[model samples]
Target: MQPILANELCKDLGSFSDNPQITGVITDSREAAPGTLFVCIKGERVDGHDFALAALQKGAAGILCQHDVEGVPQEKRILVKDPLDAMIQMGANYREHFSPLLLGVTGSVGKTTTKEFCYAVCSAFGSTLKTEGNQNNEIGVPKTLFRLDSTIRYGVVEMGMQALGEIEKLTLAVRPAGGIITWVGQSHLESLGTRENILKAKMEICDGMPDGAPLVINADNDLLSVAKVPQRLRRVTFAVHTDADVRAVGIQGDEKGTHFTICDKEFGSFPAFIPAMGEHNVADALSAYALATRLGLDPERAAQALANYSTTGHRQNVVQHCGVTVIEDCYNASPDSMKAALRTLADYPVCGRRIAVLGDMFELGEISQQAHESVGVMAAQAGVDWLLTVGEAAQDISRRASQLGVNAVHCSDKAEVLARLLSQVKAGDALLVKASHGMALETILEGFYKQFQNTTGVQDKIAGECKSWKNSRF
Candidate 1:
């Protein structure tokens, strides 16, 4: 981060200080260093004020705190009623000073991957900074803003929410120049209740957008396909299965990646490839391509850069383990993303059966069973041969698949599921492992890697190759 006067940080507190220059901002006190500004956060488990003195001892230049701590220089101390809000206000103040072209992204399923595609495409034009990992919440957005400087030309901020008004707060912090709404789905059904409410919440990304800012949306989603946008906001639609301003046509995929033709009304048509499979990923690429092109990036060059796009870990990572093809997509799951993974699994050409080992889909509230069963029906329709599941909610999936005459098993124990999979899985089969994040399905992937180490040396390769791309900083 560029150095800023300590007085500028305390501007929200109606105070000014000329004694210090803060070169960096951090939330954790342990990360404090010389020329660093520490913002004390009161988390559920730990309060950061207790560590403020520790941070000062580590050479912090200043501290933003709700309460005073002993041993801090009086000249650098800035008091605020709410430190989080003060941080957001400071970040917004900093953002307005630089005026970088910011692109805000919000969605149910593909926000991270879509943001990654935006990073890869926009980097072709100039320096770009994107939200790291799942840092799309109130705290995360401020951290992302803190990283912005004069060298950055483009900023991609991912916004996530579990209820209404959360995205509004984040957008107000970002005040983006452009926005993208990847397809809305029933991700947070527990709190938000329905897809309609989810759509309403996701649209809040534009609540803080500037006038005349282009708002890109997925035209293929059933909800977004008919949703209305504010008249003052420019809406750009991207689709793969419907007529829209931008589209991906002639889509083809394999275990390697997806190849498609990008059709834009203004840019004509061009071939593109993303180094990731699944049609859902194609939609993500289209949204990024549309945003990058609108920002004056060469359409062909932007499309070319997408070929190097890599998905973050556990989201459809294909690997060869123990001579078996494993699509380790167990990062997180929703009904929409589960169906997309099933389709990708079905599409992969395999000499043996296409097996799907699914776990529970969390946060569905009253519709959890129906949502899991819906994925079961989708798996059957997608031609899944063997369906193995864990968790009580996934029992519905196994039952539905069994009723559909597909080979299905609902295991009650992780050990039993592992033993069954180890006994039956062979070299030629293609397997997909997915579930909600709380299920910790990655443990199963690790167990598979350990159990297969005696048969093949592919475990080391999978670990080395499948590191999450979330750490990539543009």
Candidate 2:
């Protein structure tokens, strides 16, 4: 962000301060540049206040500090109750200078994919600036807002949260002109405790929306239907199952790609194609199509742009390992997403065996066991040939698979899983690796990739050191 005087920022935020013009805002002392304003944030591991002298020595023009520091000059410091709050105020201040249509997106799943789709569609309409690389949290959101400058005609921001009020802070910072709630699901249920609470937290994105701004919603989510969205705000609904303003029908996919039909209120039904899997993704495409249409992009052009949309890494991305097809969705998981992945697996034509390498879902709180077991039952019912589970909580999934007479293996660690999978998987098998981001299932995926390369005589094209056990030559 451009350097602004401390006095100017205080005026924009409506906060009282003696000195206003204090250069740039920075969170890390190491990144503090000359004539910049350093914000000393107390985070989980590091305390920024302790680095005040370091930042000043690095040429920070001013500091936003939570506590008084002895070495820093009093005139160059702006004391606030909370540094995070101060950062939020700065974002609000920065936002006043830009006149762009702010599009905000949130949901239990598909937020990132939907955000990408929105960026693609909006880019076709005007100059766009979007969230780069999962910068959707407390720190990331404010940082993203600061990146918005005068040239950006439209701003698409992805807002994520684990608890209540987080989205409210972000929405207030950007004051989005439009919003999209992808779908309500069982993610972050550990902290949120219940689906109802999750809905409330996601709906907080609308708390700071303008009175007449468009708030797009998924009519399929029962909780969202009952959300206390403001009466003054304009509401737009999209769905795949029920009749809505935007809908996807006749969806079809294979190992190669997916094809579907998009029906809109004004444009009628149009064929839309995406190089991705899962019906949920088709729904996400519909949301993007609707938003783009509302923003004045031609329906045909928006659908064409969506057809070019491809899945990002680790989110249902398909890879060929030797002769086997591997679906590497190891980025993250929840009960809803797990079920969706299994359904996709079920739809694929498997010549030999269909295997799922599952891991703990995490953050389900007291219901973790039940949630895992529920996914186990889903895998069994979906006709998975074998179920391999990792972590202590995932034992419930393995047990449920066994109870349903499905071949299930429970491993305490990656080594045990590799040993078992190496013995069972053959050339014609299709395997899916999925778990919460915390489980680090990508390590297990890398192991399988190495095995495939060795057995099938396929060299690793991606150059990097193998971080785990060496490839076991059979």
Candidate 3:
């Protein structure tokens, strides 16, 4: 980050007496260095106010805190009502120095993939920076905005929220030139009550953009399909099953990648491919394509750039182990994403059978039971040869799937899940492991790699190939 005066950093947020030129912004006191401004944050477990003196002693140029520290002088501190809000203000202040063409992305699912797709598309036109991983909340947005500089011509920020008004604050601060709402699902139904509420919250990305700024959307989403947008903003649509301004056709996927044709009115049609599968991923790429084209980028360049898109951590990452296809999509899950993953699993080319290990989908509130059961029905509908479910909630999946004639097992824990799989899993079987981030289902794969080494003495050769799957890769 470019250095700014301590008073300048305070600009509209608070007051600062000293004029120390702050070189960088930091939250942790341990990272405090000369010319750096330490922003005190009062978290649930640790309070940054208690460490203000330590930061100052460590050569921090200034402090932005909610309360005054005993030893820190007034000249070196910027006082405010809340440090988190102040941090947002600091980010907005810092962002005032650059003029990058910023775009904001938010949704119940596919936000990260769409953001990465946008990154690939935008960077083809110029240098770009995007929110790394799932950093798309209050704290994450400011941190992402802080990365802006003169050299960056495109900036993609992913915004995530659990309730209403959260995305509003983020979009106001981001002030994106354009926005993308990938799809609205029941991800935060526990907090927001319904998909309608989720849609309301997701549309807040347009709260800060000026009139006519394009807001790209997935027209295939049932909730977003009928929902209304602000009349002043241009709604750009993309989908596979619905009539949209931008769409994907001739969609097909296999082990190597997915290939499709992008159909846009202004750009005509062009073949596009991503080194990943899933029609959902194709929808994500379409959204990125729509966003880039509406933001004055070349449509052909955006389509070509879509080929460079890759999956982020633990998001439907496919691996081949022991001559079996394994899909590790154990990041975060919702009923919608679970269904998508199951469809992808069903589509995998396998000689023997298709097996699925589905865990719990969190934050469904009163609909949790029905949601889990529906996933079980989806498993059966996907023609899964066997369904193994972990977690207490996933028992519903097993129960419902079993009622539908699918060979299903309900494991009490990961231990039981691994044992049951080890006895039956063999070459030519395709396996899918999916759950919410809290389930830590990745450990099940680790257990498989360990048990494989014990049962077979070819552990060395397997280790050379799987690398123990120690790093969540096989």
Candidate 4:
């Protein structure tokens, strides 16, 4: 963020006594330095206020705190009713220092992929900053803003929320030029209760847009297709199954990627292919295209940019290891993404068997059992040759698949899951590894390769890590 006088940024919070030169904002004291504003956020495990004195000791210009810290000088502390909100406000203020066509993306699934695609298309025009990985929450939103400067021409952020009003807060801070609500699902039903609530929360991305700004959405979604959007905003729609402002026709997918004809009512249609698997990905690519074109980029250039799209980290990223085709989508999961991965693997042309290694899908609340069972039904329907599941919640998947005549194996922990997979996996098989982030099922995928190298020590270390994860987080 550009440097500014502290008094200018915090005039409404309280007195600007002994105002400091604010160079940037930080939440971690370890990264604090001169002219840095350390925000004291009260978390469930660690309290940021506890690090206030440590931040000042490190030459932090000032600390934004909810209350007084014991050894910190009163003048060095910028008190507030809530430091997190104050930091968010600071981020919104900091955004005024730069001019960029900022865009926001949010949904129960696919927001991260959409964010990456948005960045790719936007960067074709100029330097663009995007949310790093899946950091789409409060802290991540403001931190992404702090990366802004005069050099960035476009900004794309994925806004995630657990309940109502969260995305509104983030969207307000982003003050998006335009935004996309990917598609609502059951990922955070634990907090928001119903899909109706989820759709409402996802639409909050519109709250930050200018009156005439475009708001893109998935017209294929039954809820969003007919749902009311703010009257002042221009609505843009993308889809594969339904009529939309922007749509894909004759969609086809191979193990390598997908091909589709881009049909648009506004910018004109063109042939497009995204080098990624699944119809969901095609939808993600189209959404990115619609959002970019709505922002006035050349339609064909935006369509061409989809060709450069690739999976990041555990998000549908394919790995060829030990002569096995591995789909390592361990980043996070909802019922929608889980089925998407399974269908991709099912459609995958394997020399021998198709195996799916699944872990628990988190945050489903009352629907957790039904969600896991539905994934199990999807696995059986997809003709998975073998099923290996980790964690107690995923056992539901095993039971449902086994009842449907699929060979399903449920393990108490990742260690057992790895052992079963190692015993059954052969050179000709394709493996799909998926789970929520906390379950850390990627370790099982990593451990499978280690066994091929005959590294028992590393294998044991992986097992121990899984045990620790099970004992702690799971």
Candidate 5:
């Protein structure tokens, strides 16, 4: 973000402050440096207000806090009712200084990947900035918007929500020129109550969108496929199986990557290869393709850029560890994502058993048990050789898989899960480790990388060293 005087932030956010020039903005005190504006947010475990003085000690230009911070000069602090809101307002103001074509992406799944894909595709057209890591919530989106500047010709922001109105609040802050809804799935079902409500929340991405702005959606998703688009919005469709405005045909996937034909009515058809293993990822590519086409970018160029698109860390990362091929997708899990990963594991060729180390999928509300069971059914149908389940809720997956005549085992914890997996996996076995982010299933992947080292000790290409979002959000 461009350096702004404290007076400007105070005037924009309606807070009290002197004219201190701020060069950067941050929330965590540890990340604070000289000329930084530290925002104090009250999270579940800790309060940022407690560390306001630490940030000041670290050369923060100012602190945005709800309370008066002691030890810091009064002129250096912007006092407000809510630090988060104040930061959001400042971010909105920061965004007004530039005119990058904004693309806001949100969905239960693939939003982050789709955002990255859009960034890659649009980078060919112009300079692009995308949401860093998993900063897709109200706090993260505004921080992402703060990154807008003259050099950036495009901004691809990912918007995530836990309930109704969250996406609305984010979209209003972004005021995107275009939007992409990757797909509506059973994520946050515990909070939103049902898939319909999730769809309703996801649709709020268009709330702050300008009238007649292009909105791209996944046509293959049952919830998004049939949703009626408002007349004020120009709707663009993308799908793999279903007929749509932009569709993928002649699709093919192997251990190397996925190769497919991207067919658009206006752009005709072009073949694209995404260095990822899942069909769902192919769907993500289609979502990005739709938005790029709407933005007047060349379809062929966008397709080529997709070939350069690398998979985000721990999200279907195909790697060879300990002489075994591991599909380490233990980032976040929902019923939809779990099924997709399982299907990818099934389609993935393996010289040995196709093993799936599954874990609990959180936030399903009353359907948590049913969701786990459904995943087990999917695992059985996918013909997985083994299903090693972790966590209390994931035991249901083991029970259901056993009932379906698949070899299933329920482990007590991550160590047990690892032990059972290592005992069964062979040299050519393809193992998929996946679960909700809360479960910390990545530990299993870490263990595989650490304990089961190959002669080279590190295959950087497949080792997944560039893991992001290591810190989980509640």
Candidate 6:
């Protein structure tokens, strides 16, 4: 956030203003330092316009509001048709000043992981600032861009959308020089209706790419396999299935971690390892490898960076509790992600019962039942000993698992799931708690830890371990 005057911001946004030396742009009144320009955004839970006076009272340079505030001095405000659009425009304007090489990433799944991978690889070359946490949407994207400083040599922005043209708006704001689409899948298919529509929505990130910028894509995805790129852009492809521009040979993963080799005749085969579970992460690694190589990093150096990088919170992080292992992958879920998590579960060495606590996979739309059933079948095929599913939509999973001859129970809520598992789940059991972010399955993980604490009378020891686990980024 290098400070820029309002006049300079207006030049970037292509807007006309009589007073152009506005100091800074802020979204929250709480974050409005003195001499800041506050942009009032209308959000789902709160409206920023309501806090205009509060921002002004805190020494805001000016207000970018949708409408006039009742008590605030009218002369201090810049009225706009839409404050969100104004924020985007201002972000674009602000971003253009620094001109860092922007790398845009999007896909139905693995966007965050790929963002982390890209950050890891790019950091080897120079200072890089990537999208923080899961900040990949319109609001999050702008906030991420605002964090950019003068020392950053590259900016990796993850773009995510559930509807058409959303990525286009973000692409316009980012004006990325390079872009990567990880893969197209059933994620957000409910909103976009079909895979074709999903592909179309995902490709919107390329709308603002420069004419000669490179557009990287996964060569394995059926939708992206035969897709054509714009004539002005160069295409680089990567795959784990077939020979491509960047390919991962001998890909392998276990409960401990995943190991693979990046095959490149020019740089020779380099072994890469990530202390994370799942083959999907291998795909994410490949995308990052391709992007980093394109940005002029040594293949071996980039691979080493990825190998040293660890998983972030709630995404396949393994926690050992009193002889039991819990794979806490409850961050978010989709049909594709569920299958990937199930595969990781299958990879774990099990001496006792293999258990799974799954919740609803939201946003499946018309295909919700079929998706759930497929996941149930997958659970059975993965040899899960006891399957506990919560939520109405996941009942299909239980039914399908039953048809496949797996011991499955459909719980009405988390309470019932915990009650059913309390007696059955014993020491040495491997449990996986997974669901979409809205399901809050992490609460169930907390409940399990509490039970372990109470039964062992090792509450202090367990509390210390849980605290360390909670603070652990991976």
- Candidates sorted on lDDT, descending: 3, 4, 1, 5, 6, 2
Candidate 5: deviation at residue 316, Å?
0.6
Flag the better candidate by lDDT, 1 or 6. Answer: 1
Who is ahead in TM-score, 1 or 5? 5
TM-score of each: 0.90, 0.90, 0.92, 0.93, 0.93, 0.91
Instruction: Extract clashing residue pairs from model 3.
Output: none
Which of the predicted structures, 5 or 6, would earn the higher lDDT when compared with the native? 5
- Predicted candidate 5 versus true structure: per-residue lDDT over 1-474, tens digit per residue: 788776675566644445678778889999999878898999999999899999989888888888787787777776788776676677777777788899999999888788888888988888889998888876888889877778999889999989998888788878999999988889999999989999999999889899989999988889898898888999999988899999888777644577888989877989898888677888888988888878788878989898777767788888886657788888899999998898888877655688999998989999999999999999999999988999999999999999999999898889988777656665666788999889999899887777664444434343223222122110
lDDT of each: 0.84, 0.80, 0.86, 0.85, 0.83, 0.81
Tens-digit per-residue lDDT, 131-175, candidate 4: 998778888888899899888999998899877998899999899
Report lDDT (Cα) of residue 470, candidate 1.
34
Model 3 poorest ten-residue lDDT run: 465-474
**Worst ten-residue run, lDDT, model 6?**
465-474
Model 6 Cα shift for residue 48 (angstroms): 2.0
Query: How would you encode candidate 6's per-residue C-alpha lDDT over 89-183 as one tens digit per residue?
Result: 77787887787888999998888888888888888788899888898876788777877888999889999997998899999999988899998
Task: List all candidate RMSDs to the true structure.
Answer: 5.1, 5.9, 4.5, 6.7, 5.5, 4.6
Which is superior by lDDT, 1 or 2? 1
lDDT of 6 at 451: 79
How does candidate 1 fare on TM-score? 0.90
Give per-residue CA lDDT, model 1, range 257-338, as digits (tens): 7788999998999999888877888999999999878867798999999986877778778887765778998888999999
| Superposed model 5: Cα runs more than 4 Å off | 15-17, 72-74, 453-474
